[model samples]
Target: MQEEFISSKQNAKVKNWRKLKTAKGRKQQGLYMIEGEHLIEEAVRSGVYLEAIILNETYEGAYPTGFSTYRLAAHVFESLAETDSPQGILAILGAQSRFNAAEDFQQLLAKPGDAINRWLLVDGVQDPGNLGTIIRTADAAGYRGVVLGTGTVDLYNDKVLRSTQGSHWHIEVVELPIETAMQTLQGAGIPVLATALHREARDYRTLDYAAGAPLALVVGNEGQGVQAKLIEQANLSVFIPMPGQAESLNVAVATGILLFAL
Candidate 1:
């Protein structure tokens, strides 16, 4: 369960761990890192594929069994940790296997009795915090899954992971073409609701979301609203009726409002 102590920051293993901070490095290694006991535990509880666990030399805490554990020098651990207060516990996990959106959509529909009704389809959401909150909200609202379109922030980014607060382990998050995902879900009798600021958009409050009615909510970029081409594919377009004279809602806040509305 324990390995020889790692003292050098430039040690081969240490260098590999540091590489995870970059998207290119993560891609090349096909691995990502999760920090803190909570996220590490979430990864284990969710049955995520873990490569190993790393701890600081001074860490005297106990950890869950079943994975190889390594201890690094205090400085080495601090250097690898993204946060100021490193919990001295972290896990290296393989990137989640890619899901085929169309196939997953069909599989979910097949289980009509147990099918998840509300789905969040994200399009070009670039902010890691916004994307993370959206994922967490989707889980809390009991949505089935989240389909992230191209240009959405990487789900495994440390900031995004921290923002989710372990919600990523609780729900399905997949990346796929937005238009294709919309079409597949629609073909299965699910309605696609596009959040937009168009004249024809209906007020979100006027809608009633009944149990067992499958639907997908499409949200877009922080600055620009949903892309016009993507919105054109929605079964309906709706917007929050803000009477307070605010220009618009933060994408995450807007997503929370609309997600729970369903």
Candidate 2:
């Protein structure tokens, strides 16, 4: 493997890697960074094209071979790392392709054979851990993809990435307006279900969704639930029954229940 060493935090490459910690910087550079051995392995297994592998000068662990590698000074690696305990390895990868609002929706609607049978739509979910957990759960439940609606946390956030436990590489994730996503799925003959406790909502278990039918479930913000407008637009509304004293479920927990039940 081709390798280089970077000892100065002031190096141009170090400066750029530091920029990847923010959403805006990632967007500007079309790249993001993932730390640790597991994520890097997942990226390789998933066929994600990695830009470069980064290592702390002192890291003793064996790293993947045949990729360009960079060894940084301990201080430099720590400065670039998001976690308190650095794993001594990280990698740069291209950002997932952004959804083309105008063209991609049309293509998705047109391609019946390529349609994902199950999708999770996230709206206004601000917590990184919650969003990541939701994605991981969706992957576990065999969902095909996740759509990140407006007000959702950035998918590339380090906390979010760590929370996913590498499931981020296993499923399709796209960002689009919630309304547009709903309309597109509905247009494609998929039923859109919004999670809410409105009077008209149905018990999620009561719904008779045919086996393998296309479905989209929307889970919203922790405090507000699904947006009223989105709930109104959904083909159906659903709620998990709670007989206990607890008033509600965590968004991630609630999503896992709904995903597996439906």
Candidate 3:
């Protein structure tokens, strides 16, 4: 592998690298940038399509071999970095489409080995950190996949990606209309439960089910909770009873608790 050195920030490649830091640029180019050695390690281990790897001249850490590599001047590297303490390594990776078609959803459900029936659905989860934490928690809780509804934060946002800690590669993430996803799951005989604080809502712990039965859990926006119309469509509405003085739990924290329960 040849190591190219970049000294001028005005170079076209350097300008493009800086552009990828924005959402518009990422969308236009169909690529996203991840920094730090840990994320680069995760990307290498997952064998995802990588456009290139970049390093600062002073970096002495190990990096994956057999890929396009570049060494940048310290000032040039700082211009492209978003973190205070840069690990001196960054990677540009091809973006994957978030849309998992309805047919593909069914195909995943009908797979031969390890039928995945448990799903976590998010409706208008706007906070990047919250959404990322929720996705990471869903992965840890062994959910089949995450369905992101409209009005949710961008899945590929830098903050979200960082918060996930590479959990995104471990699980499937699908962006689809909440109503359509809910209907599809319900038609497949999976129960759709919404998390809400309503008089009619039941305690999450009281849910009755077989160990391996198909289930879907819907978590909503941080400020408003689940939309009333969506909750109305749910088979049941459940809440984590809080007897303390706090008004409500953080959406991510509530999601983790409910995911483990259901």
**TM-score of each predicted structure versus truth:** 0.94, 0.96, 0.94
Name the best candidate (by lDDT).
2
Runs of candidate 1 with Cα error greater than 4 angstroms are 100-115
Which lDDT value does model 2 have at 28?
Answer: 97
Put down candidate 3 lDDT per residue, 71-148, tens digits, no spaces: 999999999888899999999999876765787777666665343578899999999999999999989988878999
**Which residue pairs clash in candidate 1?**
none
Give the alpha carbon lDDT tens digit for every residue of 124-219 in model 2: 999999999999999998887888999999999999999998887787787899999898888888889999998899998899877687899999
Model 3 lDDT at residue 57: 89
Candidate 3 segments whose C-alpha is farther than 4 A from its true place: 112-115
lDDT of each: 0.87, 0.90, 0.88
lDDT of 1 at 242: 87
Clash pairs for candidate 2: none
